[model samples]
Target: MREPADVAVVGTGVVGLAVAVELLHRGLDVTVVGPRTGAHQGQGTRAAGAMLSTFSELEPQHDAVRAGMETAERLAAHQAYPAWLERIEAMGGGTVQAPSGTWVLAPAGRRSCLDPIAAAARAAGHSVEEHDASSIPALRAPASSAGALWLPTESRVDSAALMEALSRAVEQQPRATWISQSATAVSAGTVACTEGETVRAREVVLAAGCGIPALLPECGRPLGVPPILAGRGVSARLAAPGVEVEQVVRTPNAEFACGAHLVPRTDGTLYLGGTNRLTLDADPAQAPSLDEVAVLASDAAALLDPRLGAASLLDTRTGLRPYTLDHLPLIGRTGDPSVLVATATYRCGVLLAPRLAQLVADEITAPGSLDAHPYRALRPMPAPRIDDVLADGAAQGLLEHLLQGGGHLPPAQQDEFAAFTALALRALLDEGSQAGAAVRRLWERAPVIEAVPALFALARRLEGVR
Candidate 1:
């Protein structure tokens, strides 16, 4: 180990970068180590709508109401969202923008779907207006759709630009340094890098997404971190012709995959995304299937505009969001004393970074300065059973795939599987396409998987003969 600084942040995604910048600005010596796309680029932070939609991400009021002010806490979090975005923009010199409000739609027949959301938003005192899908030409609400609600205050961030801007801004800080390397192991104040460098720091922040739980054991204090899983998502970017979309649009229900949403970049490119499936390998070299891209594109085109389907395919990107057992972010120190946990913000990482960083930095400089966040590393939430997870939609295909050759699978189902296999799973939609690859790598890499007995039962149900 050489030149141990005051702080070492072992990740460069939005959360890690934000924490590093915050600490540096707080007058602490800081060193950041993570894989780099180039001399100054980051992974994981890419591939997102970068929407700072606080209310949009919340569960409906029905659940909140039933939980008895359980959501009051989330509303408090929402109140601080805008301020955090402003803080980040100030650091990046206005590189990120929440240019316009976000519009959410419920398929025509499902208008009722917007109720709980609207209720929650109204409870938060945010103005909400309900209207038919036709209200927004961009959403192209089908007759089947129930309608939608618009939250003009909800906004999107230029995720790619913000990421680049953060990297540059962080590197320019006199007290901060960005080291391009993969961390092999991390403890309270020491981080060992794959590049054969050992960094010693006064304290360390482990914000490496799914890698958090995996690395804790390697650091000799695995018991301090909770079980965290990874949700892999695929998104495709399209080049919009003529006037580019000026607003964000999304479906009310996403059924088996992540929700269907569209985000327009400042440069006029539109992003149609994304699909979520359980994956262990956060850095898989695999690419999204053309069929997967088409499904998202076609859905967006149907909702937003016909031009979307005809748009040029610019590129596709993938990101693995870290998920906790309770779906809340785990921030703050662990029993390991010096190890501060800041990953697991999941889909809200970019939008919530500024505030989260502030909380982490406050804790670091003055322990217990900020009250504890709802998510704690040592919480007693039990991990979910793998079988209960299997039946979850969009991922049902994964379970089906795991039980192959139960000759009980109808001839039609087998024929369908054969078709996709012949063309390399091209026809499988949602998680089906990614299921095979994920299963093959399960024990080798997947962070979460269901139990074996459930697998056998599913297989038995699928097979005519064992």
Candidate 2:
């Protein structure tokens, strides 16, 4: 068993690698343990679609959407693609794209997806345009009815090149060691790898993506938080005739349906993705489904220019995404001081990496400034588990009615509506509700009809009832 270093980061994927670099930069001795050999070396990083549109992915009212946007801005300005690009250029890792904008297509049928989101974005004071599909040459090339939302400041990075650069960056640091080993468990203040090498550390961070809970069971409920689930994302890259797309393109639908993203690089190869499937099976070798590739390719052809039609399929890949029940990421230290669990950024891992790394690093290095209250290992309220989602749905429906036309219901129905509304509000206000903040966030975006208790409350507050 090797003595512990200052920090032992399990899993050398983008998240782990980023944390390793950050810790080393802060003058800490760090050991990155992972199967960074054979077929697994850099698999997660290689499979990423690497879009840096922090605020564009979700409903704008989401705390993470706002936080992600701010985080992306800070990382782009201080520590992401630019720094990565410089390092890649030095390493001669071919070419990379540093585009400053992201383009999203909103098909007419799916326009409802953006109404509330656009309203939310407006609340955040961001300029959002609903451009008809014809507005974009590549999008128009596909003959779709959707318009586009252009976020001019967002960017994309060549993930593979970026990962290689990170490897180089870590090598440059004298105190950093990228050890080839799989971490099996975390005990007390030490991490024991599968190969029996133990590294002691003042701080141990489990950034192993979907493999997290399996590596360290304590992390699953660290201080009573919910367990992390694995969200599988499959993607394929195509060799194209250098389609000139100024920004990343995504179609918003109930599901990603015809949703496809086209990320172009100077190398004439574009990375298209991705099918997000939730599963407990964590196999990296699972090839992209032929059906998925065909669909993705078809969607890309519809959304991209003629050049993409002539492109050949180069390769397909898959990786596991750590998803929490609530979409927000799990960052900061656990109630257990020595073990810090930083996983579950979902699909936004790349977008959230730099900020998350810095946040974790800051907490570990300068503990006084960060208030772990919000991200406390022991959540002040019980987290909403997967089973609770069903109940939350019913409560959501009741609350909507009361907020809207509950007063319009007949007197007999009004009392029932009032009862339903009260129950709903009580559950919503309860921190233990599985829906967590999603119910409130959604309500803020779209008003609901008043049904039960809300109707009663309104009738009582107002002069007269029916």
Candidate 3:
């Protein structure tokens, strides 16, 4: 038994730490649980490229409400980051090394994809400047490259440094307790850990990311929390001897992932990222595959610069990104008011941390503040329309295939292939659930097909209730 605290924050990833720090700053006694080694294989914080991209991450959403809510959250985080970073630094968290601005480029044939992205950014009041692909300094754009759009507001930080700073800030807080152990269970006001240790608190927040599903059943009461899957993303660091870029450069959002991107870090290294494979097993010890590494390298060379192929691969990292059925974050308190959840931010966890932390803290300090909030935990998650799913799946599937050397196909053949893909996706969705022939045939190739199981489950649950 341990002394009770005001709040017990489970999980030590970026969001967890951010929430703990926010609560502590508000004069609350906090006990932070979860391992601090920063070596968790699925930990998103440390393995992140840490892009503060509000506009660069945008993609067309089928659901208007979901899109509006997500845009609002992203804009709020973008606005809050400067002040939030200042406050963290004031707490001796160390200055974060974040390069300003980002360049979003489209491959030659894909130039049209940049239109909606640029339009969305401009609509959101962020400045978008057009630049000739060849004129972009330090970039060896392929001869067939389309133009580029420079978002002056987008930024990125050194993920490792940011984590160190957050951990240091929490450690130095007098009212904060850092428990370097995994939390096994949580009751209304108590959290149980390995070795039989427990910490009682007035409120318990489950920001465990992919670890949430395991602990949900152990809660003293049913949380009615939605299903969360692990989107395992593999990224690598490279030492490109003479290759240098002053800004973050990335492609627009791809099929089931944030397209390949390069972040120039303060340590004179480049971060190459953009692979996502959703899995049912959220194993923290999962290893990055050689195929993932090779694809990342190949993407960098083909999409950004040919010189990157020779860059020394400093290391590879794997992070499990938590995502819900509709691919939106779950924030705010659950059905059990004393229990709150703030996970499933997916690719935007790093970008949305500050805003999410503040939202969580506000709910704790002032109940009912978030009663009407759109992202309130335990909200009904209806299954997305099957037609929309098939269409999006086919589009993304074709894009993925084309990127992987299918671009060499003749125009007529490409159209035929697209039709085949659409039909294939429709057939897969008809098979029902993730374990069916759908997952077997398209799990690795098509990203959207991964959500079928959860969608079917949600639809069935909703139907039963009706």
Candidate 4:
């Protein structure tokens, strides 16, 4: 292998790009490997609207609250957007007009959800105001929401534009390289890509979403160090039809879990999103059911005039968000000195990128600088029993396709399925007196449901059944 470059980021998604930019700015040679030449131009980040807020009208939690505070503070102190904007204009890239604040709206019935989040936000050192239905519309136009809370510090960015600008900015730096290829595996200090290139880096970061845990062998972490899983989100983008809301609007109780966010861009484009679909593969072009679109449209029309609805839908897309089994980001270095795990930021990837990048870069450059306890590579958690996993697969429809649809199993789910099938095959292969009984038990208990794809996957896992 060639001598190690300063750093090699295995994915050029938002987190990968952000870390590369931070490292390069700190005078490190960096190479970004991904299918795209641009940073953050991959799936989810490219489709996101870059809403930097701690509180959500739909669901508020401590992770986002803390992450949001850090992000807001950093953006304000570093003037991150201004620096990004300058680069955008220089590269003839577009701009996203960020309002001075953001608003979280609640439906009449779901007002109770606000109390916990609001209290948490206040404790986190942010000002939160509770407004009646009347004040909400006046605070920002098209305010038909039942109630609203204004966050003065929250900001939004044009995700695609920022990604493009970041790509250009990094390219302008002589030490930065963007490799257009997918990494096949990792060894010692080098990452092998499908393009017949092996890059040796002083340090390697596994920032590939959904694919993180699978690369554990190369990350120098345990095979299953991170038990994180992936969840899918789909979004739609539309042209802004002159209906301006001074802040990003989030509605709860809409058809989509978080309702829809209407973020008006500086260039008059409005981003309307989105929905959470838990399946493994969420292709962008997958058309959302009419039911989903209606919910988003209804939410947007309530916030703005119906004219905003007059705009045509520009694109529909989906992103696979890396969700930990416990729903927190996995950051910090592993026992392996050369490898780092930075996956499972889930929905907060964009909001938490700046600080996360800092934490990651620090861990890479100075692994001994901090206690790696919370983020250490050790997995104290035990792998759930294959029986329990099989039940979950049944619940998640891992076997339904084999029974009803005849669909193919997803590759990621195949591992868990293999474990399940091993148990069933063991029973069958045992050749004991009760082997027939085991088959009946498996059949009776492993039926697939309509919603869970994992069940169908589990059924297929019984590949060596006697």
TM-score of each: 0.79, 0.73, 0.90, 0.70
RMSD (Cα, Å) for all candidates, in order, is 7.5, 10.7, 5.4, 9.4
> What is the per-residue lDDT of model 2 for residues 141-175, given as tens digits with 9 covering 90 to 100?
44544456766656787787667666677777778
Which digits, one per residue and each the tens of the lDDT, describe model 3 over residues 261-300?
Answer: 9998887899999888667666778788997887788788
lDDT to native, each model: 0.65, 0.61, 0.79, 0.59
TM match of model 3 to true structure: 0.90
| Off by more than 4 A, model 3 | 60-65, 218-221, 393-402, 405-408, 428-466
TM-score of candidate 1 versus the correct structure, residues matched by position = 0.79
**Which is superior by TM-score, 1 or 3?**
3
Alpha carbon deviation, residue 336, candidate 3 (Å): 1.5
What local lDDT score does residue 296 receive in model 4, on the 0 to 100 scale? Answer: 57
Over 1-466, each residue of candidate 1 has an lDDT whose tens digit, in order, gives 3688998998888899888878877889999988656532114568777876656654332245433343454444456656655665666535555675777877533456677767777877778998877787544455555677888877777777777767777777778777788888887688888878888998889988877765666432454676666776778788867525577787653432445788888677887775666554455455776755666676666555556667788888777778766667888888876888888776778767876787889899988654455665666656544433432321334433343212135657755654443233222112343343343334223323322222223333445433
Clashes in each model (backbone N, CA, C under 3 Å)?
Answer: 16, 21, 0, 14
How many backbone clashes can be found in candidate 4?
14
Best by TM-score: 3
Model 1 residue runs over 4 Å out of place are 36-42, 60-62, 65-94, 218-221, 253-256, 302-307, 369-372, 385-466
lDDT of 4 by residue, 124-214 (tens): 5777888764554422434334566777766777777677766676677778777788888865578888879988887888788776655
**TM-score ranking of the models:** 3, 1, 2, 4
